[model samples]
Target chain A: MNAVRRRALLAVPVAAAVARDVAAQPAVEEDFAAAERAILAGRTPVAGGIAIDMPQLSENGNSVDLAIKVESAMTATDHVTAIHILAEKNPVPRVARFALSPRAGRAEVATRIRLATTQTILVLAETSTGQVHRASRDVIVILGACVDGG
Target chain B: MIGRPAAALLACAALGTLAAASEIRPSRDFLSPELRAQQDDPSRHPGWLWVEEGEALWRRGEASCQSCHGDIAGMAGVAARYPAVAADGVLLNLEGRIERCRTQHQAQRAFGYESEPLLSLTAAVALRSRGMPVSVAVDGPAAPFVEAGRRFYETRQGQLNLACTQCHDENAGRRLRGDVISNGLGTGYPAYRLEWNALGSLHRRLRACSLGVRATQFDFGSPEYLALELYLASRANGLPIEAPGLRR
Candidate 1:
């Protein structure tokens, strides 16, 4: 074969493989961005004064315990109004949203969530002053055995 | 310093005692520290969701579990003595007994095994017995059933041609893929399994194991599984029930 023709033939398979990998990339990023935009409503959240406490390594992706806290006095004038949880790579990035007020006594919430895979979990706490504080933690999820049984 | 033959004899003696000891450990002992912590924390444990559902079911109607049993706290230690022969002479596990109550006493249709409502009620009841040691009877009318169960445990089955004892008894604590092998104890039932993302009965877990070995998956509440449950409970005698347990 001619030199240019041989190189073109070899490049075809490599280009196809690369295309397949690109297609395999998580397509939910756009959905995640849209969901975040809906929650933030054009406000830019600063990353501080909020914390997410969760295991660094999760044994399974089915149920993961998560806890979130924000620094606030929880007063009527300066309280956390709502907390939004999002998993960047989940089919639906929005995991949960909790509405709170000064009556809640503390700016904290805890719950369990299902992780689709190893991904970053984002937490957003909106204060009464309309300021949004953000925090995120990456978790490594291990697939469980005997998953085919059911 | 010992001679070769004497050292070999000593090693055999040590193994013999280890087998005879048959030290029973709770399945939680085999969990990662994070999972173990999750199992212990009521707020964090996913099983509590089922427990809450169970409590709601307990008081749903006039012919409710609450009306008959009064306070749920009164059920403490009840699950520890289950898998017993009922007055009708049939062996029944906790789930089986719950099924009978739904049909016979309440005049309600069977919730069917492994249904969310049934699992919820069973988990609620089993929760009352948490921390209490298992004490199922293996003698009297239970003898034959226990014998059958023991036979099943010892005999090889399925395409894998492996018995329960082969992995659970001989190779427990060893790695099976990414997971650690557990002693196959049934103290935890109607427990929360992350793989299921819901609470499941011991029978469901057993059916999964059967499928894993390419064996015949038995029906829920089948006599064979009931007998095996009895045997497993007896094997776990004196081990605290960790029902609504957290498992991956």
Candidate 2:
């Protein structure tokens, strides 16, 4: 595309914004409990403390950035102890397991991950009390859009 | 002449191994002929936005790519021999290297592999290397890296159960859905994407495939990605590097 034509297409940021947002919608996970069960394997499910930040949609499945931040005081009584990341639909339910301490300062660790397909990404946070929190995101990968090349 | 039979056998084995290693593959079938042909025409109608972004950033570095090259047109053939071991001795592909430059030079956080900035910047750099033959040296430490990369390309991943070579190598130019599968080559990245209406990196392209096969993705700077890049550079050893090229 020439400079002039591209300028014309991008002139409308609203449409561009809509398209961008629409393309990034997250995937849906059909089964979370089963996935959680596999990852936890003999562990117990807890309540109200984990939040997963997933985009509404992902145009690409490879290297989608994932981050988890749990609300914690960082004191012995309420610090986040560990974080577990899971991909509900992937052959391997476990994505990554993170160990944490009050010294971590915050209940946060960020990394990019490959999404096998459009699926639910779940994050489980275990607080110092063993209290658990969970959050989920739906990600999607547009088929045939993988190798756009020149 | 009566030779040492056992020694001759070992020598024969070594020679066979070298022959196999040096054997070159034909290029992967590019996308549909229509798409493959349009990849280089800047004035080609109905362009890819990712390619556009790449072009924009190349001439005027996007915030992520700002001034990394210092002097453009002067640093020729730089992208062709990438996935090189950095000063820290860590290997990085063009995309990973771009992110390094993005963070260190622009003081901006790096984009995820799927992010537009990641793709566009890569495309921009690829465009710079347009027409330069891929000439990565696999001697010394680089050889091991390429070997690791080759394994990754052939390995199966995720529930979908697929290896990259399944479609790219065995079924090049085959049709899947409405698109034709190209040989999974990375020759013209920082490519313009018609679907995305933008320019993107080969890394972004790789990530997109991983997603399609339902495999978990690695980070942009992860060793795995670098390994894959090493393989890609090795695979396209003779193809011209055409970064920031257009695609669909």
Candidate 3:
């Protein structure tokens, strides 16, 4: 019994160390890749004309404010069609989708969302000309939200 | 909308002779410039989401709050006087009142404290009173609760052996570690806290403070929190309500 207890105590730290290592490893990037594929289809997105505003470090992940803007004249010929926000690791990566028309005057929208943990958020804007613009930001959340909301 | 000059005059008139004697500054004054700007701009403030959700819940729930209240316009300045002594003599804050109304009048299930729906409803109700003054009554039945809260604020507790007064009253405007401590006011609650990265209630912050002092933290809607809220409201008397306020 004494030997087993000693072994168990020694194994606990090792198990914890291994668990920490696994947690430290970056999550598979495939989740975002799949999400992007679904949104963009076969279109290759360029990383310009889209701006995302979010905090670099969030003390709480329950309601992080997100703002997205796309560079456009917002005229009949040139206007943003839609803006899609995605969280790389949330239970559902799709946070929100905003559709806009030229009447909106500016291609911008802001709202709050929940983040499950530290993850990259992608904001993609689709313009009338079939041009897809994308922006990504990494946010570190100290306490994740929506985990216990039943 | 009431113009600035007229509003100021009305405030003065309402405050009466002793208005100038109180140290009354909105919590916006205590925040950093960037945070203050965020609070001022509705587009940038995240608390609006809760308000929006709250507005929806008010109209659509099982027993909609709007059914009896009709348009919510008359609710203005109602939140500023909350944590008040109810007709039954029990001290109740906005959340408590919401629960009571749900159970008693609405004949519906009460939203648990700290739940999203509850927070949203509380924020919505409190938002109606935005820009009003903190004016909770500390007289009559509320007097005992106020005394209890005052004692809690002044008494030292926990491993740190520090009272709420030590930091909020005596060391206010001073730096502790990296953050500046302001006079612990309950105004601007149901506010978005950058540190919380979410909208939180006065009780949530009180629990945080209790934990900070290594003291016993109470449940969300506990009597301890109610008493503390009343005391904080008294401390913040005269400060304009900035519910759905942005805080860092």
Candidate 4:
């Protein structure tokens, strides 16, 4: 009986073994938490002024468009610091960030991101004022998308 | 030409089917080895400025982009098909598309829908897809999204205003204020738009359209913008994906 059981356990699927071998994957990324902590901790980015925008719901949960706009006068004294795109459910949390200056003309950037599942996306900005302005939005993703009504 | 709505659709069923078939399939294979080589090979890299800029941005962290998406490729080819409709039946471009992500789960602000910073990162991410043919699934109740997008493409917007057709179709390859107007292809976007001094999103590109027409800029993440993105994405159909593309 022991010999037979040993053979069955040895034949267990590779995926199952691997699943048990490694730490269970967190559904969302890690710095996703750390980034949040850093900004909320009142640490200002070198440059301040940021904005975040996104859809209320991601029906596909795959490719999600995102943008950030920082409030700035575009003056040397008061210029946009940076724009960062952060996500919760992707394998890596921070999607992308852009550093802006007076020459940048606008304290903003536009881009697309791959969202693994519906999760929080944060945009943080550091302004010349030693102030950090942040904007956030909630995204709802419908699993097994029936949005197309097909 | 008038008939019951249902009957009209049924009568035009074959035509719709043909259009559908044509809309989704690009003439060229998206992932051909030749194209892929031109897309991601860093040494043969046609545009290092974008990569260089992106890399510097990557390091500026705690709040840097890398803090979120480390090594874009580790995530795979998912970047290829986007600005797609969601399963919940909402048509979202990459920008206005993921609200649940930004606020609820990540406890972070969402990137502004179709704003400048978003364009830079989206372009950066898309560039990683270099050579991948643009592909968007025209599935779900997405048919309406597609149709709306198509209509928006042909419809006129803006003051000194223009339809995409005026330039892309009629004057393709012609200079517009000293710029060579290519086929209005979506092949390369989150592209480095020189005028903008940074990368631009297709919705922002359309916003420039409204500006040209002297129309008010649509609020970011509006239905009008979504429709336009869908249309533009469809237009790039067979063109090789050249995202985070460098443009004059």
DockQ (Cα-based) per candidate? 0.25, 0.06, 0.09, 0.01
Q: Which sections of candidate 1 miss by over 4 Å?
A: A1-29, A33-45, A75-79, A128-131, B1-21, B44-46, B52-72, B102-109
Predicted candidate 2 versus true structure: per-residue lDDT over B1-248, tens digit per residue: 11123223433556853353344342324543433444555655223455466556655646524354554554467778786777777787776777777678777777767576666656555656778777676645676887798799889886778888787666666676435676566776656555454555566667667666767767656788778877777666656775555455
Identify the candidate with maximal DockQ: 1
lDDT of 2: 0.62
lDDT of 3 by residue, A26-137 (tens): 4543466688888898898988888888878764455577888889999999999999999887756777889999999999898877776788999999989998998999
Report lDDT (Cα) of residue B152, candidate 2: 92
lDDT of 4 by residue, A104-125 (tens): 8888787766565567877777
Worst 10 residues of 3 chain B by lDDT: B1-10
Arrange candidates, best TM-score first.
Answer: 1, 3, 2, 4
Q: Which stretches of candidate 4 lie over 4 Å from their true place?
A: A1-150, B1-71, B97-100, B114-117
DockQ, ranked from best to worst? 1, 3, 2, 4
TM-score winner, 1 or 3: 1
B83-172 in candidate 4: lDDT tens per residue? 676668777655554344455545657667654445545555566666765566554465677678777767776554567667666665
Write model 2 residue lDDT over A1-150, tens digit each, in one string.
111111212123345444433443346533546757755656676655666665555434443557677878888677988788887666456678899988988888877565656777888887777566777777764444233221
Task: TM-score chain B for all models.
Answer: 0.91, 0.73, 0.89, 0.69
Question: Docking category for candidate 3?
Answer: incorrect
Of the candidates numbered 2 and 4, which has the greater TM-score value? Answer: 2
Candidate 2 stretches with Cα past 4 Å from truth are A1-150, B1-29, B45-70, B102-121
